[model samples]
Target: SGRVDPVTAARIGKVLGVDALILSTLTTLNVAEVGGISVGPLTVKGVKAEVIITGRVVDATTAEIKDSFEARGEEIEASIKVSDLQGLSFGTTAFNKSVVGKCIREAVENFARNIISNPDRLMTHQIELRGKVVKIVGSKLIVDIGSRSGVRERMTGKLIRMVEVEELQQYVSVPIGEVQVYSVNPDTCILEVLWAEEAPMEGDYVDLISLK
Candidate 1:
């Protein structure tokens, strides 16, 4: 029933280099005492609890709360009946264990759902491309990728060589150079080669190296 402290949230956001935070609160907890059975002279008791969780997503950069929602679920447990007289039979112990497990699972699920629904809270993007090298002129290597897939100027990518082995009859790729996009068109870009052992060819695979 406690909100995540602002100081703690800020620290977490700073560590993750993100601009958002999520806060959760437990609103309701219902406990029910289910009937128990007797094995010989000892009587066992069973209890089940249902929990409701609520949360909110906030943008730490702007200090604005983005979204909020509530989730509720009942604890799960398997039914058991006492059978033996002298020894402890299937009874309240099993139900209590199940209820605890269910509560933990539900809490985890609610936390994960809150994270999955908020996209703006997380902002690391990466893409791998397979395209023709097209041409290499002076200090630039032209590849066949564009702004449609988030390729932009100043972004760094890796130029890889895909080689087909004749004896092994398989194709493999190896990193040959790193390049930064200097200019970008609608469907292509000119990359400035930063480091390379061999010049890129007309057809080669490129991979986005710096994701952040």
Candidate 2:
């Protein structure tokens, strides 16, 4: 019903459990007749249509615009009588088959191609999964992040141990090992330790690896 602001779009994206929201605007649209051409007994003109769209990728958690792009498409219908376009209107079957429709469809396809070709920035970078280790039993560890945080079985994370840095006068995380999710619940998940330099203990942290 109305244009959504970036913050609202981000809020909606979060509610939908999506990493990003795509915001698109119609930057330009034009339809006009080009010069006419003669073919035997008839003089026909070309009707040209152009469509341009501007797209933005908004990060769901941060409400930040991560990327922006522009896509354009054009189509020309040759040998067409100007009288035949009198009733053309958007969303009608006649309009959809016209030059403008094809131009819009092509513009959308270009937008999809742009996003797919640059997946590292638009898709892979949006995941943020990290939580503290709550419990440990035998070879398994329970982590605070679960299905609610987009956790799934087989997901892996690197375990981090808090080590005190005497010189820095602070505690810092050291990568101790890795663990893979074995099962998931609403607010927690069970993980099987993959490998570790030292045994991971409770209160350690884990950072989920982003899927490629």
lDDT of each: 0.67, 0.84
Model 2 — TM-score against the truth?
Answer: 0.55
In order of appearance, the predictions have TM-scores of 0.43, 0.55
lDDT of 1 by residue, 1-212 (tens): 46466566667777887766777787776656655545457666555567777776656555456667777667633343222112423345643356644664576587677678765444333346554578888777788887766677888778889888999899888889987888878888888878888877778667764342
lDDT of 2 by residue, 1-212 (tens): 23887899999998999888888888899888886555577777888889999888888878899889999999888876556678889888888888888899999999889888887556635365898999898888989988888888998879999999999999998998988999999999999989999988899999886542
- Residue pairs clashing, model 2: none
- Cα lDDT for residue 72, model 1? 65
The regions of model 1 sitting more than 4 angstroms off are 1-122, 209-212
Best TM-score among the predictions, by candidate number: 2
